[model samples]
Target chain A: MASKASTLETEMPTEPTKRLDTFANPNPDRDYQIHIRIPEFTCLCPKTGQPDFAEMQLVYVPDEACIELKSLKLYIWSYRNEGAFHEAVTNRILDDLVAATIPRYMEITARFNVRGGLYTTVVARHGRPPASLERSDA
Target chain B: MLDEAGRRRGILAQAWPAGQSLSPAAWLRHALQLIALIRRRRPSAEIAAIAVDGTSGTTFLCDTTSGRPLTPVMAYNDGRAGIEARALAARGLAEGPASGPYGGPAKLLWLTRHYGAPSGAGIAAQASWLSGALLGHYGLMDEHNALKLGFDGSWTQILRERPFTVRLPHVVPAGTPLGPLCRTLTRRLGLRSAPLVVAGTTDSTAAFLALGSLPVGCGVSSLGSTLVLKIESPHPISVPEFGIYSHRLPKTWLVGGASNSGAAVLAHYFDRPTLARLSATLPLPTSPRLDYYPLLAPGERFPVSDPRLAPRLSPRPADDRLFLQGLLEGLAAIEARGYALLARYGAPRLQRVVTTGGGATNGAWRAIREQALEVPISLAADRPAAFGAARLARAGWLDTR
Candidate 1:
């Protein structure tokens, strides 16, 4: 009963959750691209605990499933208080998205606003791993 | 914030809230809707012409035949073309302020290759594409949009040796009337007559135009996420080494340079409330000489074009107010040096500076910048880019008609 109840709760999200949810792709064969831009993204700096602002762009080609928009928004908001380097955080976002959707291809481009005096843009990508391999490669 | 004289003239003001991250289609639709709404509200007015100013570097590829986007629009801040830019730089094709990955040309190459060259597709900056969409033409670009695309007096040369053949747009001067709004658009919007669609400039240049005209030597400094200085000059200034270039105006050249130093650094260090608090306690100390070269990384393009330049934010002062003041003073010094470098490179003398962007709101920083620049620093005319575009529409197309 407990396991069933937990599964039911997970299936029907009651609030903004970190767990990314996905729906079956309407066009499984076509290789159309999905682009999402998150402009007001904020995270904490690992070193100073100060805030880092970035406009993150996610473009992907889904395989069998596509990410749900509300869940993706919540997934992004989860990083609000997290402290990570630009490169690491960008790659992690890509990693999470690819894992959630098992996308054929995914790219995360995070343009971090100038910190000291330089603007940093970190682009991370993921391609489809071999089907024989059980895990998606970063 | 119109000037006293402008206020007296009583130019009609309208506000339509806008946002970032709009696709090319959305941008066009919103623009049409906004114009239609304005006309509906004021039935007595007849809009003679329309001019647009899009986000400066935002670019997209379109199929000329259908006037439909072939790929997702690459925004100004989108840096997906880093590898393509590196390749161009390796071939010595990357030059000028727009050589970076986010530049229009780089984005063009990336989109072309990525989409495998859809037939009859041409890449264009946001303003060019939007203007063309309105006028029912395709592959027409303005000089400001074409500059980073390597459009010389006549043609764009993406390659140093040969003309770029990816359906390059025909270049036109700003304020030149392209044509009337297409029949479909006119009928849809319920316009009595097809409005003239004038050639447009980039958003930043349009903002400069919104300054309501300045003297030859006068300049404007935009202290947004980055710092930009533009001054009017008789002759064009092209210093690719310092990331400086000039855009042609009707009479003079708008010589300009940009530095990646400004409010972004402050936002990175402190939140809004904290910054407001720190700023309130300013005019603190001009002494103790905290002459620092603040950078987010080890690179600078203007006033000092060292890619390996290191950021200097050491010797932490215990007082938060002191630290804030030091950063402000450091930025002011950079601004001063930037104007000096421009003058050294044959740009106009620093007659006066009209300040724009978020940092301009800081009065203490303004005082510091005034002391550093040794020139009259005043707030820019507080108006949106739409107002500038409207001014261009009036001056370039409406008045002539």
Candidate 2:
């Protein structure tokens, strides 16, 4: 699979031209118990060979639209080996996600395992009451 | 009811059948004592016929009258009795002689031999547990639940005289009214005011109903937190080798297995909208690298069937995003292959795939699947196990409106 990808390196990949997300149903009301775990995640600046890290986990209940998996995977994979700091990466993933799927309540956590003897975990969340799902609790 | 598109769809439900392995003695143990939950709930259901079923081949030790459980019910997925199951098949005491974690009688024997069963409920059945819970009595076990536990599929022999090897549930037909809720339950749990309960079906059975009453060789691919590929067959495929289960569906069974690889992996990365845009940019299934079995993390069940199987992205990934894309594509391929194998064996060829769960709602994944499998897939109206569970509680949720 690696060789094939390399041979086709000249073939421009399907990178997005513009990042815009629209929803059919803007608000929804439902109880949700969403859980996620990322056991394998690594990031580092192209210039620095040192390993940058994030413990990425998200659990949310959905009302109208939830994050799509394939696209989500691609979006996450897009950050790998990029020149982004830990905090920026965490919020960026969350921001892009919120824009894509207008969920009722969202929680995004990035737990970067100990690197350089320093452990960093960032937690971000937004919630909405069942009755007032249109507003965000960011 | 017709939508603007003019299509037919409805909610479905069911659960595992009787003869599903829990010894009747064990079920009775809990059944006799289960009076507590009822007493606590004080269910006052108005009344109709009640349905009592089991968790696929589970029997308990119970006290007869109150249907209180004496034994701990063994789930179909529990594997403590693999040795006993194999021994039973070896002795010709079981049907088909296939030994598995889901195999019923073996687990029962293990419980019977090790613990001597629960008190009060004594030895019991899954249906008995449910019956005791709902009606305050242990009714007979239904057939599908009965069969999975090594009972002869033929309901005529009555299966009572088999041996001290295991206890059996009182097998009954669907819609058969066992009786009414106990007065104590009526007063305590408020079940007395409840409408009639039908002979409830199993979880997977309800899933089958939820999907469609897909005939012989038909099945459902439940892509939830776990990717479960269930296919119906002409012959019961009870091979423990692949995590297959003998379903209560008379001549049919629910075969195939679950893989840790599922939408859970996707959830680890994207939120939703960004996921949609990425969906718009999915590469065609032309990647030469099959290096990705695509488990976002560690371990997988179906397809390769290796628990130690680690997630591998070939040629190593240049970026997290690239690695993630490779993973998603791998999952899509695995899904297609799993369903295709089922089709090759027993299930009908992929004509229309009905998808459910939070992940299934994603158009991007759906499109990728359609292209990967070369078939049509649609999102269901409700993507919830609760919906199906309610239907099972209500018998066939579809036959009404």
Candidate 3:
């Protein structure tokens, strides 16, 4: 019976923050998957200092705690001005999210825009989904 | 009108009509509008004096006797007199202000050529004509406006040597009292009495006067759409190659230049709300080391006067806040370079900087500028050019008495 304002007040951070937040999972006993599509991820290219834009897909299965959506968004925004290679940034994101939520399984797939006539996609993962929840999409 | 202590008793402003062409009738209308507003707000108030300040180089030809415009205004930024400017430079007026296409003399030449120089037509700076309209007199222009019109104290020697067939206005120092406001305007606007119409100055000089007074070596950086840096110097310095010139003040020279980079480029990317929000979030000591020359287009004046110079705003970072910081840093660097150039050209070394215009309100930008300038920075008085004009009017009225 949460009011819309009350829900938003509880959920959204007052300002952009780099610290990711987590809440105890509502249904920790269940084996459901959480899929997040971040369409506006950006970071600087390490060598050239030019911007590199990418779309990221994060899929994870919760163990006991769930990553807070708004905090995760802000966490992703923190890398916007940082210079990092595509492979490195994707792995770093996966590591940070895994460390925060301590999920049973997590994966980050980043598809970057074309540069110098080449498009790059980097995929990084931690742990594995339970055998019963395994899928070919990965 | 301001009190003896220089505090405003009343103030009003009217927006100029939107157009490329300047209209004398519009100027009169706006003046009347301001007068009526003042009368409405403070019926008991007695306006003692009035003055006008206009863009330094904007000028047009007007009938000598009738005070009617003979040609459209050549705006301060208009550059249609390139050939005439080059011709003047070829004749050895190269180092003077009048050799620029946007300067008053070159534009006057262009007007004469296209409009067919008629007899009884005299040139008028925007401020001169507006002031004359109030006094029912024409042909008396202040020295600040007259500078760009080839008058440095005396009509520039070259102009005196080859004199134009077109008449030149009698130049007076700024704050000179011309006469009383015409009886017709006094009655039409319902003033208690005719106030003295003082000879005014160029707008930048008016802005400087708004700061009350500053010692030599104090610089005023106007962070408007373009960055203009003016410093008070003991002696005149003129370096036309760097697009630098000096306007003669009562006791000192106001030396400066304008650059193409400033808050306009920030506006190109961020609106007010976004700018404020991003500005607040910007980390202190916000040097991203992005060497961006954030020009609106490919030309620069002052510090680097190359007409074909391209803007250098590449390697833009992904974060909006970081990009904003980079732009601010670039502007601060340009301002520093401007002061350095002025000093190199024999102007006084800047001891302090007072910031004016829209960008003055930005705290983050101010911090960045202080770091770059290596001088104490302060905000200007929250007064417009009109306030400075009122100060001039007060001085002129007192002098006449």
Candidate 4:
């Protein structure tokens, strides 16, 4: 059970707990992560209340704060009851991640298989080495 | 964002509250959205510290006394500006960009001819309007966006030349302090008071911020429907033949030009469904059947200055797929030509390009662009201008202090 804090709201299914294989200190003291997954991941449209099927694999590194999987799971679950276009959903997730965990290096790529006769894969990444990237002056 | 024709454009950055189009209130609404987002992230943020950068050249009519915008802004794309453009050209006062039509002079001319635009409190680009709205004083335009309007950022002229005698906005370099938003707005907009509104910039300039700092030759390709290429320069290169603009980089100029051809043509034949079903059949040829000049419903600029232009496909393919693939090849080739143009204008010859837009996401498209341009072209690593603006806001606030 997640330590429910009054300041933050999170929902976790209580039917039958499926132990998630997760951990910390993977980077020792540095900000980095390497996630391993087995395909199947799903959610529902926030508006139509229809299921939005997707297979996702995420790998992120943090600077200030790292994402909590259970919380992230609930967040993703929340999307199941909401509705949004794919583009909007993808960006909204990225924005939420960035806001939730101030990561130093992060990359999220959504590779949606064929849908409505079109295949769309959207990716957004951000990373800043301690100093500004060479040529930030332009 | 780039248009279907691949023209890199600045965002209006104003709120579209249902049916509202052009007005100071709309501009303020947009600013409020930014403020709300920022406040949610940085609760104690200051107010007076906002500077608004908007789409350059798009003109709006504003009322003086009440500080309201006139209904239905005479748009930048309105061809009605042609008379003014012609008048300026006839008087040897007009300059042309790589592509024809949709320029500041043309829009302004359209304003004069159609509206008989009377001198209001002021007239300026989308950025200036927002800046004026934020500060309550209609006295500024960031120098970054005024170059297209005949306002000189170097000597900061127009005060003398009275270019067009159209009251232009006060030009400030990006990041300049515009003081705080009035306490009235701060309280009304929820929170954050006395925050500094740093002189905001054009969406392109903010995009440049997303590109990181400027040096020379560092070009960003906005590969949307319309392809727009902008590169930083150490000096001004305002040849009308190239469609370049002078900016506030002081030592740098932005070499930009639009493509009269873009995705609209591709969309004409293939919708999202057809494209998915047929990516592989788009011809295996490394070159085009005919050296193509891709265009849409109208004529082209850049390669041709003729305005009454019509979209044409040569060596017409026997099938829709063949033609589209051929069209893609031709556009890819033009992407190369655009880069070559930037190089010719003395922007540090782009060795690699960062792209953001619909076209850039297509793997096959990226391959074609990379092969034709003979350079590594990568999609932007972040979101669009909003990311750029957010990054700018974070860095700018730090710099101003």
Candidate 5:
């Protein structure tokens, strides 16, 4: 019992784990949307060094790998104290997701709750459109 | 017979089924059914003028000749136009509160790219399209709906600079008379009198009008999931930096701003039932000691425009009631600060506050707001969008005469 209790206490890390690791996608050949909604997203504002809150949604179609949930949560939590603007943070998240999964398609939508009176929603996407939805001219 | 004093002028409230689908035709069909049902119940009630309030920023592409929608209505919340918004912003064409992906202009641009607009097809927001259909016109749109389409009051040259080409609707003020109701619509509804179909505003604006009579100095505060503040200003105030904008009313401008803090933060901590129970017994703040910025997360816009502002919900007491009281007081303080900010920005002084939304019914919250605002606070006499639409119709008819 003493050993179990000690293991539990030590297992919980005090600092955020920024490492975003991935695993092989079970269905690599097919294109499917992976929708992730993070309602309690928080990061420091670069301008004021104040904490910015946003509700964000990350959608992507995986190619070879899929982002591990535990690591992704840790990676998002890492932004808590980091200073970044709405547009920069949104693009950075997309870049990180792409690097981790090498997704066929991805879109990150971050709606920073109203500040002053304006609600800012930043959407950044990468990769090619699926074969079915691609424009004819493109 | 009942006494003259006992008789109510309005029709008895009847619940109608609300059916909202992705398709524009579905909404139109539902609307037609609602109108027919209302007319059938009250045959003696002469229909004077009709107005519709639609979801702001919802856009659609349609053929003018056939009055048929060419594409599914892109909802106000749709984010499919994010790429287009960024591209437009890059070109400096789309900037401001109306430049986001969910905005009408971005959605219209997205529609044109995805489904090429044929010649004679027009792009319109939901309210514009509905009113146009009723009035037997295809190009009529109100300025309120046109705002998200980047139409600044009377600016057509600005829209001409966009990369894509689609016939933009003719923008008019919200209460302007479009024309008499179409012969086909009148016959379909079996109305004795053909009511004039007027240009309509967005749902929120219609809600403001529904409050009946708001003097220049009075304001209405919507305490929903978010806190929205709107005051009638003598001169139009256009401060987009703080997410504040003015909607044109006949003699006054409706200057308003929205905040991230409200009942949503309260709901995050305690359920509605628990909040109600606690609020009933909640103690008042004696000396304004436990100050909090009750936000579900960090960051707030209105009153203070700090993008990184942190939620100040610390040093919470053990008793749930006390904690709830502190949160209520904090929200009231924010409300007071928002009005003060508006005043600083040259909006008319807030003489009285008319409260609406789910949070408005709380007596405890009202007391807190009264003390914080140092102004008379009263619940809105009526808040239905329908009542506001009726008021618009009456005003439009009066204006035409």
Candidate 6:
């Protein structure tokens, strides 16, 4: 009979990581969109060192590679204790994603919660959408 | 709660729910659950009083008029107020319990700056807020919890000197009766009568009280998520640089410091069952000889109070059992150094160490700790912090009669 402890040793989750990971896109020949929503994004305020929370929406059209889900989650978690402004952090996420996947079109929108009677939202974009996608939307 | 003859009638323990922040709603839910469980188990038993103990520096803002939470809880280990702590220190408020980023004063400043203090805003500790919730009022705070809020037997002076805009709680001694539980709770919980709500100490202090009695030279090591070391001393000691401070008791002062290294570091790498299994197979004569300072993150609080201290878990060995031994040995070494540091800072020399918390049950770890500490290690008779809170409740109820 196998003990529960012995069984659990082999099923442990991987440690959190800071590096973004990607895999080869399944349909690189065709142009399609991917939307990822991270509801539990949290970072620290650069000035006061207090925690700042946001809901991140990432929309991109993959070219040669696509971002891996678990790796993206870990990458986001790596910033839990880091201190950065909303604008800088939002732009940095888009930049990192673009660098990892080299997507044809990538956009990141961060909706930060209200702090001191002010709500902050930052949007960053990389590359341009294809004319075909614009025409389809129209 | 314990009866007059000091025999336990009923007891219950509940873990904090997963993915739940330490908010007022979560606290009330747990409190009600525990009360209901105890009542169901011992229906005929008459409850006399209730006291609540929480982490020493855990605090949040609340509305004074409505007793409503206005901000999220700043946990005891939250180090986001480093800037505010430094600012306070620069203003010559350095030599007290509230001198670090984890202190209540810094958290309050951070909350005020970020949340914007309203007209009826006030600060509340976990124990105070819970007790107030029971009493339908919210201004009272125990002295032990207030210690980290810069309360040194003088709230008026502290308020006059500091630049806080929120209303500070009225601090009282532990075991002091605040009031009877509100009638609504009695009816809702189906209790025969409202129990007196007693002021409670911090969780660690409450644990200290659970120890039946200890001599001046005796020490207690709490191996919970963090390594907390407290020794009974004739005089209070304060060393803010090393994160050492003293909590006042009726007869003696408990001088101690907490380390960032403890069982939580092990929990990061292995589950509880895995830890127990691996610990059973480790060689007991000597440690794996890996000089590792295990930390979950980059900061340390005691024995070395550098906020930027990096963990030294490198020079990896392939064997998981060896690695577990190394981590256990590292924690034991930290415990030794913590006691040594406390002694260096005017605390009483440790004659014996009474161990408490989850790690106390590990015989292998205990043997290693005894070897490192050079003192006899004994497991506490009662390990739960609630038992101590119940003791406080019993004492307060007796005094009133």
Q: What RMSD does model 5 have? A: 24.6
> What's model 6's lDDT at B241?
82
Task: Summarize candidate 2's per-residue lDDT along B190-220 as a digit string, tens digits.
Answer: 4435434445555545555434333233335
Q: Roughly what TM-score does model 3 have, to 2 decimal places?
A: 0.69
Off by over 4 Å in 2: A1-138, B1-60, B73-98, B118-128, B143-148, B151-164, B173-176, B187-194, B211-219, B231-288, B294-316, B386-401
lDDT of 5 by residue, A31-57 (tens): 677888888889998888988899888
Candidate 4 fnat reads 0.00
- Compute the lDDT of residue B35 as modeled in candidate 3: 80
Interface RMSD, Å, model 6: 28.9
Tens digits of lDDT, candidate 4, B308-363: 67766787867766676677777888777877866676667775565656776565
In candidate 5 chain B, what residue range of length 10 has the lowest lDDT sum?
Answer: B1-10
DockQ of 5: 0.01
Residue B192, model 1: lDDT of 96
Q: In CAPRI terms, where does candidate 3 land? A: incorrect
> Which of candidates 4 and 5 reaches a greater lDDT?
5
Better of 3 and 4 by lDDT: 3
Model 4's TM-score against the true structure: 0.67
* Interface root-mean-square deviation, candidate 2: 13.9
**Per-residue lDDT for B1-401 in model 5, tens only?**
00111111353343435645566666666667767776777666676777888877888889976668877788887889989888776766444447668766678778988888888878778888878778777888888888777777764343566555677778888889989888988898888878888788888888887654444466789998889899988888766657677889888888888788999989999998898898888565453468999988776667665556899998998888878888999999999998988998999887667777889878788878878898656565333666566667777887887
| Pairwise TM-score winner, candidates 2 and 4 | 4
Question: Across residues A5-90, which tens digit of lDDT does each residue of candidate 6 receive?
Answer: 88787776765555555667776546678889999999999999999999999988776568889989988997899999999889
Give the number of the best model, judged by lDDT: 3
- Candidate 3, residues B1-401, lDDT tens digits: the string is 57543445656777666872388878877887888898898788777888999988999999988889889888898999999888877877765566678877778878878886678988898899989999988989999889888887677655544446778789988999899899999999988899888989989889877655554466889999999999988898888889898877777888999898999999999999999999997655545688999899998887888877899887888988888988998999999999999999899888667678999878789878878898656555455777778888888888877
> Chain A TM-scores, one per candidate?
0.80, 0.69, 0.86, 0.61, 0.84, 0.86
- Candidate with more favorable, higher TM-score: 3 or 5: 3
lDDT of 6 by residue, B42-153 (tens): 8887788889999888999999867898988899879899898898777776555677688777888899889877878898998899898999988999999999877877
Model 4 CAPRI quality? incorrect
